[model samples]
Target: MSDTLTTIGFDADDTLWHNERFFALTQSHFAELLADHTDHETLMQRLLEAERRNLPHYGFGIKGFTLSMIETAIEVTDGHAPASVIAEILNAGRDMLSHAVELLPHAAEAVEHLRRQYKVIVITKGDLLDQERKLAQSGLRDLFHGIEIVSAKTPEVYARIFNAYGTGADQGMMVGNAMASDVVPMIAAGGWGVHVPHGLSWEIEHAATPEHKRYHEIPDLAHLPKLIETLTQGQINATS
Candidate 1:
């Protein structure tokens, strides 16, 4: 294992940019479209269920989300949901797909500052085309040394990606808004895991706060550099 950090992996959705909020917006529209078929609360619950059921088949990102919504609509309406409602659902998904990228506060600054010291990479989970489109739109794509859009964020996956991108998981760090996907697995892979909450997250992405030395929570990415530096110093001090 290295004595200090070498690679820094960042989650794209709701970490470096606004993501969940768009999902929230589209979900709201979905509820409205089917307001007569089911109440918002029940509709949302069913939609969540559909997303969980469909995740393995469809994977992550707007396309999967859209299919989940459509599935939910058909379920609530007993396959009687109007063609218009289905059309609106498709439209909402497309709108989500094309929405302009809005970088979270201090995202660019923190990544740029960190990259000067570490091999910074984007290890986000989502559809390849949509994620690549968002990265291109975010204006920060070129700042990264690598990008890995994977199906899931497991310990083995993190270890593999970290090893491929930089040194190894032991000397790498992963930053993101989702504890389940970003923090937990990365820490489990023997690296630092920094939780930068975006205040909005998909329920499926939620995980309990881990009680581990390598796990950390920060209000936002703005604090990432300082936290990394402090951790680096701590590692140096312990080794010395």
Candidate 2:
């Protein structure tokens, strides 16, 4: 274990469990309800655009997600959707949003492994209430030493977290899913980062990767413990 890596931060949503996939499935069901007026792809695009517009108002959460689906459903339907279709859309969105909470495979094990040797912190951006509820439901809420639920994950956020934890850039590592929201800012803040790409990421987060030595990309949560062990081993070797 690396004594140099005193603190490690993790992303919550897609990093710890299934998130955007649920939204995508809900959106698919929602688009089906409005297929008479708009196709699924078009409906999804408009909803993404709408979400970009609504971010300032809603932050991040299922409430905003469901609202975006309803907004897009109404917009695409051109006011001609039957009450049944609208009800179905609402119910489907709500059902998915209220999805039974569970942890991703290996999330618990990886966290346990890291926590044994380092200060494990969760740095996630989302609606505070929704995030808290999910964390509570996932049954891993007690595992983390520090939790950062923020409105955004930017370089500033990374810097603040590093400073608060009293760790320099070399001693702090970030693990998250979105390149745009997670890796980019951590790199910009001069911190090391691990990218665990989700199966479905937001279109906006699909940006060109900036080259950096401290960045490591892994396939999924199952590989995380090994990756961390390797990185931590290197850090330990360097210090010793």
The local distance difference test score of each candidate is 0.92, 0.80
Local accuracy of candidate 1 as per-residue lDDT tens digits, 29-111: 89889888889999999999999999999999999999999899999999998999999999998899899999999999998
In model 2, residue pairs whose N, Cα or C atoms come closer than 3 Å (at least 3 residues apart or on different chains), thus clashing, are none
Give TM per candidate. Answer: 0.98, 0.89
Candidate 1, residue 121: lDDT: 97
Model 1: lDDT to the true structure: 0.92
For residues 1-240, what per-residue lDDT tens digits would candidate 2 score against the true structure? 124667788898888988888877877777767777877778889999988888889877777777777777777777665778768867875676567776777888888888988888899887787788889998888999988899888888888987787475457888888888888888888877789888788886776776887888988777877876887788678878
Worst 10 residues of 1 by lDDT: 1-10
Error of 1 at 33 (Å): 0.9
**Which candidate leads in TM-score?**
1
